[model samples]
Target: MPGFVALTGPPAVGKTTLAAKLAAVHGAQVFRLREFAHDVRHRIDVDPALFATEDPLGWLPDRTVRVLLDSALGGRGRNGVTVLENLPGTIIQLRTISEIGRRLGLPVVVIELTASDAIVIGRSLVRRVCPACEPDLDADPHRPARAAAADSSTCATCGNPLRRRRCDGTARYELKLRRFRSRIPGIRREAATLDLPYQAVNATASPDDCLRRVVAALRSTQILPCLPADLPSALNGATP
Candidate 1:
């Protein structure tokens, strides 16, 4: 069995981007919890009221766990690491993940990305998602090239128009951020109790810099074999 890496972070903190990069480096499959939530919502015709709650996972059916587990363990080939994004949001979900990890005989490493609330809010305002590539792009005023691309309403990767998710407004984003903040302590405690290798990476820097920090943290924990040779060149000298 291969190792398991799970990423958790507040909204707009670049969890998806980091997960994508890690998956690329390890030749792993990325499993996103939001995608699974969407499938469950569509299948069960979830109540709109559920969206208003701080805990959206509470509305999901029991079978949702099975789906998540299958995605994490089923299709991934032998010796293939799996990178999980925005998963195990609740204590119940975390416990379930612990069980699945044990059953699969894969050690789980959880990395949480942390950023100031102000930075998170600013990122939420200008962040755009590329549907085809499934990665979020920073389009803040400071990033001129990315901002220009976003202004032109084009995805740099797929040449499609960028998109804003429904939860992209100030009020909704703040509420979601609060919910994420409330869960952090509990998640950390659970991870410690489970004896999982957990670390918090600062996400206030550029994405490349943050990725370097994450890679370094993983290397320190011995979760990653080593930094990929091409990574330094790709990241403009980001060392492991």
Candidate 2:
């Protein structure tokens, strides 16, 4: 049997950050919403909203789902945990995903990370870009500064401009909050109904400290067999 872990939270609340860290520590493979959307986008000519409106079930086909389930269960010989970020699209579909995991005999854990609204706003403001096409500027050595300076450059990864045009920081923050509000209700509701244990993490603190707490939380619930004895210290301050 395999194991599945899902991370969900409000905007800029560190779901993805924790997912990355969790994947690193546990040697898990990540399957994020954006990456999943990207895969679907490459196959179909449709906007995000269009795709969402058309196939609310998920971006992938039924066949793809089966393949993914098999792979996640180690049927294909690729073995590791599956760390899903922004999964379980809506409240109604939560059980379906959980059921799949259960049928596959995978132990599933869900963690919700949160922070102050202000922290989310700040994170959205300076989010960086595709490193390849956005060349560095001598004046501003940092990535975000250089990206902002050469904002018009096309992304080497996607060939899209390094832009926040339609969904800049303010817009993204607003949309994120709106989406968060819409999603949290269902997340909480479904969590209450599920057999899987749910954990809430205050990621407003430093990532390292947050990770320590997260590991401890998982350990407390007996989700993991054991946590490493020598946990690393959190870098920077309590908040970033």
Candidate 3:
């Protein structure tokens, strides 16, 4: 099916983790908001300071996002769902992506993954992104990302040392979470105005359970072509 499944939520909600899993199941193209911004800004000479941890999205204009999305959709073949991580965040972004979705004959479904502050803060302590796997101001959106644990020393995929994201620090993460909360209502309203389906998923459960909820929600919307056979009936059951 030709459609998009956009993921949105505060810090440590596991947007990337869920997106990766969903992309694997659907064989979908994946777009991370920061990486996409980095790619476009690099091409057009956007000021490096605009990407500062405190206000990464503050200076990113909707026009930039719209043009990039249009160009991206124009270049790619529509075959399966495109899993977007932490995208369509602002009202303008919501409106712009919906326009692209309409003009390009693709459906847009927004999925907001939610987790409590306690859970998110706890996750922040453990979440680590591999630098060698993905460079900051990332130019390559398709590069593989290696997820690492809090105490891990090296990247599992690339064998390079893993590092914590600067923005993942306590104060910065809390700031980003506040920004996410402030902007989401407007984004949700925009989705409603555009007649797009928006779903909120609680992500405090185990990763498999959380993924199941997301997959079930997407399946209910019928954006996917069919049920994914890879999903087991139960993670653990009696051995026969």
As a TM-score, model 2 comes out at 0.66
- Kindly provide the TM-score of model 1 when superposed on the true structure, using C-alpha atoms: 0.75
For model 1, how does the per-residue alpha-carbon lDDT over 1-240 read when each residue is reduced to its tens digit? 366777888888887777776767656677765555555556565554433433442335435655556664655424666777776677767777777878777677888999999998888877766655553232211111132354557766558766665556677677778888998899899999998889899999988898888878877675576334455565797543
Best by lDDT: 3
Question: Which tens-of-lDDT digit does each residue in 43-124 have in candidate 2?
Answer: 6554444333344222454344444444344441125456667655455445655776667666677777777778867766
Q: List the pairs of residues colliding in candidate 3.
A: none
- Global lDDT of model 2: 0.57
The parts of candidate 3 lying over 4 Å away from their true place are 42-59, 137-151, 158-160, 226-228, 231-240
lDDT of 1: 0.68
Ranked by TM-score, top first = 3, 1, 2
Candidate 2 pairs with clashing backbones: 206-238
